[model samples]
Target: MPPSLPSPSSVTRAAITLPILARAASTTSAGTAVTPNKPPPSKDHHVHTYSPEAFPLGYTVSSTHAGIKKKAGALDLGILVSTSDTPCSAAACMTRNVFKAAPVTVTSELLRNSNGRAKGFIINSGCANAVTGKKGLEDAWSMSNTTTSQLPPSGAQSDKEGTLVMSTGVIGQHLPISSILDKIPELIRTLDDSPKSWLDLSKAFMTTDTFPKLRAKTFKIGDRLIRMAGIDKGAGMIAPNMGPPQPPHATLLGVIATDAAIKPEDLQNALNYAVDRSFNNITVDGDMSTNDTILCLANGAAGSAEHGGRETEEKMKELTEKANPEEFGIFKEQLREFAEELAQLVVRDGEGATKFVTIRVKGAPTYEIANAVAKSVANSSLFKTAMYGEDANWGRILCAVGYTPLSPNPISPTSVSVSFLPPAASSNTTPLRLLTNGEPEPNIDEARASEILKEEDLEIEIDLGDGNEEAKVWTCDFSHEYVTINGSAEEEEGWMYD
Candidate 1:
């Protein structure tokens, strides 16, 4: 199920209350240092805000010294190192695309080698360590090892902690590790006990992403407040995957940190549950990445919830979900909700997306089937371009289904039925061959169709007419802007390709 929107309380006041909370939280911790040219609250849904008190896991972030994609700059790298060996857990869902990136491959190995034990996180934006083969792997491993070595030795200094690393931006390029190494010292100096630092870290991960993405949660155990913070990077090429096709399952790259006092195993379980409900539930491109990673680290700095403080528990429950009796399920639910919201923001800012569209597929044999059909519609360039042109071309939607993996190979030429809701983008004055079995009349008024296409949100559903599989995928319409964003580097600065 597409997870029903949280109780109206969670989102209803989010717009208004969230801002007050962010302001109050910011002023209390870091004073009133405002950012410039900040857009008014009502203008864009592409960015959201939260309180810092929600993440107290003592974080130290530094940038990548290597600089730009092809040039050297100041502070483009970052690290999220924990001060303690706090127990942590995570769950991720990556791209199904076969050409996985080097960073994704190495990070998967590290996570598997450590068995959920992640110490710190390393990330670079200018280059995506992909398609470089052995040398790329070498670069990824070397970067991981360097990050591992920088941590304050464990033994007596701190308990045991694991590390996760991520890279984003144009694919098929090598990272400038030397520049990153040199800048590490200076980047480290900027780290203070402030939330803005982590926000800066999130911003540094952007490639074509227009804004920093982040989410935080705070829960009170007994007399203490436990906090978790996360950062993600994705503005394009997103999709759903079945994961490894077997075994321990699949994962994604979503970095989350918490300052809760919980056992490592417990944290892992919580993280898994959270990801399943959150990141795993979304799809943007139907084209998975080779470098999708999400790692969570914990440093028991805030201490766990005391078992007896009823007062503290109630107060914490107001903002943070409770974890006892498992009744406090709201914590992970809210996190997933916020994360989905963040992911949508990425799509709204999708390189050239002037409008964000949501494709909902229901009434199928299973969620998987619905998802398959959804992706077919979401990823089809025909469907996308039609969307871009504001043309209600149901034929394109039907064409997408015909090519989808779900389409019966031998081409069942029959046994399938499809339909579109009223105001569909079709110009057939007469009811055409819209229904194969028990489907709607395949005809729509051109005027109504055009009006429907003008709306910002879109919903498309398909009934395989098979059993009852259900799936839903999300994507933006293909526009000339998308083309422009994907063009050569020079075109990115100015000039257009005629």
Candidate 2:
């Protein structure tokens, strides 16, 4: 639920600026097309895309903050209105933290107020309206209200185009809402449904992120085939949560749009289920944030009324409930796979990260304990530092396992088994110096370990040997460049681990 919105006075208005288009590639994929040695099945996979016509419900998206990362200059606010306003339906997942941002709080309320229906999103990045107390809350709402004043109500039984607002940047600072508000009119005047428009709106909401993250999928919900478009932003302060109801202190913001005809309740249910396995399951540094948010807006533009009125929603609900694993198994797998790809992009872009690390923990007391242990090890600065140094620090791995709270009783260090496989020719590997726990086989080679650490992808496995519990954690090796990029390390390059 959203906190009480302060009176409009809490927020002031700045003069409006003319909307200007940014110079970016019309392409909507996350970054320069990933050139894999062996590219996946489809070069242009469904994992990240934005087809202008995908959303018949049409959309109105815009950004007020950009150009900060470069500090070269500034541009006017951006806006992108879709081509249609058909009856829409959508679902979303958000950061599960208690000190939620003002935008997150207000969005939840708007979702309910609009009765689970919405038009699209309006977002800004330079300033995050977080922890500003009453003023922040009012400013977030004010953005929504101002957008509402300019756009027409989505034509539906609900005649209201639900507007969602999002923000990202420093926490606990006052947002320059007046500057954002001042540009609303110009933004509305230039709202075009162009590929460039989509790209600009996406680039507008970036903080430290280097590239834009987006995806599109067409799902067959009965006889209706609906297209879903989504965009997300996150580069630093990541460590998403699943077990806890509240997100850790890391934040992620996203906007999902679809042009399908479905009720809000149904949309919410489907979205919740999708997110549990998607965004909720991923973690980077084990830290969460106060500004995590993922919103979905459906305007029912496609108008597929197979199950007229509540009938369509009811039938889909029944099928979803029965969990006919075989019926929509294909759809489910695609959705899950798409989400994993999206989450991987987040890890690949971790701040100052150079080596992508995958930590797999097996033989734990329980799944819950396994994850806790995995995260404890993965998020450790010591462990990550060791990876960056290319040192096979087996002791840190064992130490992480030993500190895990999952053990029901005390267990000797001998209970655990750890191994370092030199990198395969096709893949990257980690250093294999045995620090502790396992005796180094007399034949264990040293040159092989060094060669393996040079690969771009690295994998590490820890066998707790305690129970059957297991978990997987994704992370990156800490390098001095990371410190330099983040302005944390005093020297231009990071110190050597050795």
Query: Best TM-score goes to which candidate?
Result: 2
Compared with the true structure, model 1 gives a TM-score of 0.70
Give the local distance difference test score of model 2.
0.57
Per-residue C-alpha lDDT of model 2 across residues 1-498, encoded as one tens digit per residue? 012211222211110121111211233376542211221112122234456655433565544433322254433245444435344454456666677778877877776666665556677766667778889999988988887777765444354545677777767567677777887776777777555566677667566566667666666655555565666777676776522122223257666665554456655655565555456545555668777776655554443444222223222332232354443444445455556666666666666666677777777777666666667678777677766666554556655655555434443445556655544655444445342233434454555655555555677767666799787777876666555655553121212100
Off by over 4 Å in 2: 1-57, 60-86, 157-161, 217-226, 242-250, 259-266, 273-278, 281-284, 298-333, 407-415, 419-442, 465-469, 485-498
Error (Å) of candidate 1 at residue 191 is 2.4
Per-structure clash totals for the candidates:
45, 28
Per-model TM against the reference: 0.70, 0.72
lDDT of 2 at 472: 71
The candidate that achieves the highest lDDT relative to the unseen native structure: 2
